[model samples]
Target chain A: MAKKRILIAKPGLDGHDRGAKYVARALKDAGYEVIYTGIRQTPEAIVSTAIQEDVDFIGLSLLSGAHNELFPRVVELLDNKGAEDIIVFGGGVIPIDDFDYLKSKGVKAIFTPGAQIKDIIDFIELQN
Target chain B: MSLNEIIAKKFSSWEKNVLEKLLKKFPERQKEFLTASSEKVERLYLPFENEQEKYIRDLGFPGEFPFTRGIQPTMFRGRLWTMRQYAGFGTAEESNQRYKFLLSQGQTGLSIAFDLPTQIGYDSDHPMSEGEVGKVGVAIDSLKDMEILFDGIPLDKVSTSMTINAPASVLLAMYIAVGEKQGVPREKLQGTIQNDILKEYVARGTYIFPPEPSMRLITNIFEYCSGELKNFNTISISGYHIREAGSTAVQEVAFTLSNGIEYVKAAVNAGLDVDSFAGRLSFFFNAHNDLFEEVAKFRAARRIWAKIMRDKFSAKNEKSLLLRFHTQTGGSTLTAQQPDNNIVRVAIQTLAAVLGGTQSLHTNSRDEALALPTEDSVRIALRTQQIVGYESGVTNTVDPLGGSYFVESLTDSIESEAQTYISKIESLGGMISAIEKGFIQKEIQDSAYKYQKDIESNERIVVGVNKFSVEEKPPKGLLRVDPKLRDLQIKKTTEVKKNRNNEKVKKNLSALKVASSDPNANLMPFIVDAVKEYATLGEICSVLRETFGEYKENIVL
Candidate 1:
C-alpha cells in the first residue's frame, strides 16, 4: 500500500517547529510522505496547505500549551471545507480526560507523551 | 635450544596463538569513534585543577550554602521529584478533560501548554486565531475558557504550571481565579508561571509586547507573587526552549542562566529582596540525548547559579542560590522511523534528568513524533518515569555521575565555556543587547545549520533515518483529530461572546489598558481583575501592545 501523505504545520504564534519536524520525520519513516510548513504559519496557510497537498493526515504539534483554543479550530476548518476524512491528529502535553474529549470531538486518537507510534500508525491505517 | 631461544619461542607462540588470532577478525569488527559527544575528554588532570577544589569551594552538600551536588541533601529520600508531564490540546473543554485524566493517573502536577492564540494574547474568536485554536495546546481567551479548562479539576489539590510567556501574568491571574472559585485560597496555591519574558526575546517566540514593557511586566509579576502568592514561583527562567531552538548544550546553559541573571537584576531594581522571593524562583531545562553532557550541564548550572546568587547578588539565603529545575525530555531527539526507538531515547533522557537531580520531570511520549500521545502512549510515558524512578537504581545516590574525573573535568570545562559566553553577552551589554543586535539569534542559527550540515553529510548518524534502513513498510492507522473541532470551538467561542457580559468585559478591558500603560502597575492584579470580569486574552494583550508596542524579531537566520 502507498504511504499516506501527512502535512505537519506549525500555526500562529508558535515558532517552535522542532516537535513538528520530528513528527514529520517519524511519519516519513513510517513510509508516509510528510510536508512540513515552517514556523509562524497562520491558520489559513495551514488549511490551504492541507487542502492543496491533499494530504492523508495533518499532524499539529503544540508545545506552547495552547491546544484548548488551537486544535479545535483546525478540526472545525477541516469539517467546513468538507475534508473531514483527512485524518488530522496532534501531539503535546495534555491531560488524559482531554484526550477522550478530543477523541469524541472526532479526534481519532489523542497521544499524550510516550504514545506508541505503532498505535498511531495503526490508527491511520484503519482511517485510510 | 638455548634458554634465550626458548623464551623467544614461547613469547612468539603466545603472540601468534592469542593476540594474532583475535587480530585476524579485525577486518570484520566495527571501528570505534574515540571522541565524546559535546566536549573533549580531559585526558589527564593536574593538582592545579583541584587547587581551588574544597568542599565549600567546589562541592557543597545538598540544601547547604552554595548547593551544587543536589538541591536538598535528602533529595528523593525526602520526597520524589514531582512527575509533571505537561499537557493540553484542543479547546479548553477538550484539554480540561485531558488534565483530569492525567490527574487521575497519579500525575502529581499540571503544566498547561497554551495554544498560539492564547499565548500571544488572542482570543479563540479573533481573526488571527482562526483554525489554530487548541491545535498544539489548550486555548483560553477569557475566564469562561479558563474556568472550563479547569472544570472539575480541583486547583486546590494540583499545582499548575502555565508555559505562557507574553501572557503569563494573564494566564496566572486566570489560574488564581480558578482556584478562587474552587475555594482554594490564593495564599495556599502552589504552582509556577513561566513569566520569564526575556527568554521570549532570546529563544521562544510567543512574546507580545516589546522588551522594556515585557521586563516591567516580569518585575510586576515578581513583586506581586512575592507578597500575594508566596508559594507560587514567579518565574521559571528556562533553558528548555533554548535547547529546543537548536542551541548547543552549553548555549542552553549560558543563555538560560544569563536570562536568569537579567531577571534577578530586574527584580532587584524593582526594590524586591532577593531572599524574600528567591526560594520561589524555579528553572526549566531540556534533557537531550547526550547523556554525559546533559548531566554535566546540570551540575554546572547549579554551581554557576549558586555563585551568581552568592558572589554577584550578595544573597545571604542558601535557597536563593540553589537552582531547582524541571526537566523535560527533548522532543528533537525522538525519531519517527522505528518509532519504538523513541522509547529507548526517552528512557535514556529521563535517566539523564534523574541523574542530573531534577526537582520534577516530564517525559515526552514516544509516539509524540506521530501525534498527540494517546492514553496508551501517555501511560507508557508515565510508566517510563515510574520505571526509572522505581526500577532504576541510579537514584540511590545523589549525583551518581559526579566524582568521576571525566565528569568533573567536563563540568569545569562547561562552566568555563558558559562563563565565556556570559562574558561575550556581557561584552555586548547583556542578553537584551545581544538580542537586539541579533547576536544570540545568529549564534543559534549558525549552530543549527552546522548540526543540520553534519546530519546531511552523514557525520552525525540518526539511526533508522540516515542509516539502518528497514525494508518493511511502517504499520498503518495513526491517531487523527476530528474535522468537527473547529466548528464546535467557533460556535462555543461565539456563544460565549454573545452570552457573556460584554459591557463588563469592556469596562475591565479599559481598566486593563489604563493599568498596562502605567510603568509602576502590576499587570497580574489587573489581569486578574480583567479575567474575573471576563475580559478576553486578546483584549488584555492588545492594551499592552498598544501601550508598549509590538516588537518585530530581527531574524538573522
Candidate 2:
C-alpha cells in the first residue's frame, strides 16, 4: 500500500508541541508522509491545510486546556468543507471526561500523555 | 606498585573473572549504558576517571571566582532555597486568594501564572479569549486587575516572580504601577518578570513580536531596570521550558547559556555596560528524574556561565559572574496513570535541585498531569521542597556531590558537550539567528523524538507508564476551573472600561505609540504611564502590534 499521508497540526494558542512533533516524527519513521503545522494554528488554517494537502489523517494536538473548544472546531470545519471522511485524532493533556465527547464529534481516538506511538500506529493501520 | 597501577591490575583481574562470569550468566542489558543525552556511562567511575590535578581549578570554592561549587559560601546553611510555588488561575481576586493561601502555608516567594489571554495580551472580553479567560492562569486586563492581584501582598516585603513573556512589558508596567500604589518605589521592587522572549520562540511559544523587535524590547527592559529597579531581575533566560520541551540536560544548559550570551551582546550593543545589566540576569532550569545528571547539569551551568561572564563579556562585578537559578521539577515527568507516583517523582527531582545548590525551587504537584493542581496537591508540592530543605540533611553541605567521580566526570562531559553546542550556535550567528534558521528547534525536536522512541521501545522505564502498569480508577481532587470565570472576568473588563478615564487612556496609549517608533526611546516609562491610566493589556499591545507588527511563527519540524 502507498504510504499514508498524515497532517499533524496544533490548532490552538497552546505552544506545547512536544507531543505533536514527536508523533509526527514517529509516523514519518513508520513510513507516513507527515505534514506538521507548528504551534498556534487556528481551526480554519488546520482545515484548509488538511483540504489543500488532501491528507488521509489529521492529528490535532493541544495542551492549554483549550482542546475542548479548539479540537472540535477543526473537525466541525472539516465537516463543513465536506471532508468528514478524513480521520481525525486528538492528543495532549486531555482529561478523560472529554474522551467520549471528542470521539462523538468525529475525533477517532484520543491519545493522552505517555501514550505509545506504536498504539497510535496500530490504530491508524487498523483504520485501513 | 603505584596506586594507579595496582588499581588497574585489580580492575583488570575482576573484569576478566567476575564480569565474564556475570555476563555469561546474564548478558548485559545493552552494549553500554547511556544517559538520556546519549553520553556513555561507565559501570564504575573511579577517582582517576577525571584528571586529579585539575580538581582545584574545576571545583572552586563556593562564593569565589569561577563558582563551580555553589554561588554562596554557606549555601542553604545560611538560608533555605525559596519555596516559590508557581500558582495562578481564574480572576485576579481568585488567584490573589491562592497566593495568600500559599504564603500562609509557608511559601517563601510568590510566582504568578497569568492566564492564556493575559499572557497573549488579550482582554478578557476579546473574542479570541473566549473560553480561555482565566483557564491556564490568572487574568489581568489592566492596572485594576493588577491592583486586585496584589491587594494585600506587600510588594517590598515579598519576592514575586511573574511567569509572563511576549507582553512582558505591559505586565511589568502593571506590576510597577501596583508597587507604586503600595507606596513602594521602583528600586524597592524585588522580583523577576520572565521577560525572556528568545526561549518563547525556541521552546514555550508565547512570542508576540518578531525577533529583532523582541530583542529591542528586551534591551529596553535591561536599560530601564538597571537604572530604576536595582533589586529586580530584568530577565530570566530560561532552559526550564526547553528541557520540558524535550531537550537533553546538556542542550538545556547550552541553549540557555547561548541565550544569556545573546542577551548580553544585545544589551552591550545597545550601549549598556555589561556589568550593570548582567548582575540582574537570572536563569531558570527544569529538574528532571536523573539525579546525578541534573546535579551535574547545574554545576556545569554555573562553571560555563562564570567563564562566559569573565572571559567573554568581561564582566567585572562578582554578582554578574554568578549564575543564580530557580528550578521547577519537571512537569512532563508527571504521569496520569498512577497519580500518586508523581509525589515520589517530585521528591526525587526536588532533592536533586536542593543538592545541586539551587537558589530557589518549585515542586510539581502530583495532580498537575490531569489538571491544575488543587490546594491539597499544591500544598504537597510545596511540602516536598520543605522536607528536602529542612529534613533532608543534604542542605547542610555545599555541593556535597562535588567530588563524586561519577558526578565530576559527568559534569565535565556535560560542560564540554554544551560548549560544542554553544560554539555551533555562535557559528550560526547567535541564538536569534539560530532560532530564526530553526537550528535550535530542530535539535530539540530530534532529541524529543529519540526520547519518546526509547520510552516506546521499553529501553527507558517510566514507572506506571511502560513498566509497572496499573489499572486504576481515574484520579480525583484535580482543580476544576469554573467556566463562569470567563463571564465574571468579561464583566469586570467591561466595568473597568466604563469607569476608567477614557481620554487619559487614549493620550497615554498614543504617547506609547510615539515612543515605540523611536529606536532610542525607552518604552518602559511610556508603558508604565499607559498602565497607570488603566489602559488594558490588549489595547497597549494592539498599539504595539500596529507599530511593530505581531510575530507570525515559522513552522519547522
User: What TM-score should be assigned to candidate 2?
Assistant: 0.97
Q: Point out where model 1 deviates above 4 Å.
A: A1-11, A17-128, B1-37, B42-56, B472-477
DockQ value of candidate 1: 0.16
Model 2's CAPRI class is: medium
Looking at the true structure's interface, with contacts defined as alpha carbon pairs within 8 Å between chains A and B, what fraction does model 1 recover? 0.29
Which candidate ranks first by DockQ, i.e. highest?
2
Chain A only: give the TM-score of model 2. Answer: 0.97
Per-residue alpha-carbon lDDT of candidate 1 for residues A12-108, written as tens digits (9 for 90 to 100): 5667754455556556766888888866666567888999999988887765444655677778888989988888788765544456667666666
Query: Tens digits of per-residue lDDT for model 2 on A1-128?
Result: 78789999987667888898888988998899999998877789899999999999999988888777788888899989999989999898888888888888889999998889888999999996
Model 2: fraction of native contacts: 0.53
Model 2 has how many clashing residue pairs? 0
CA lDDT, every prediction? 0.78, 0.90
DockQ of each: 0.16, 0.66
- Clash totals for all models, in order? 73, 0
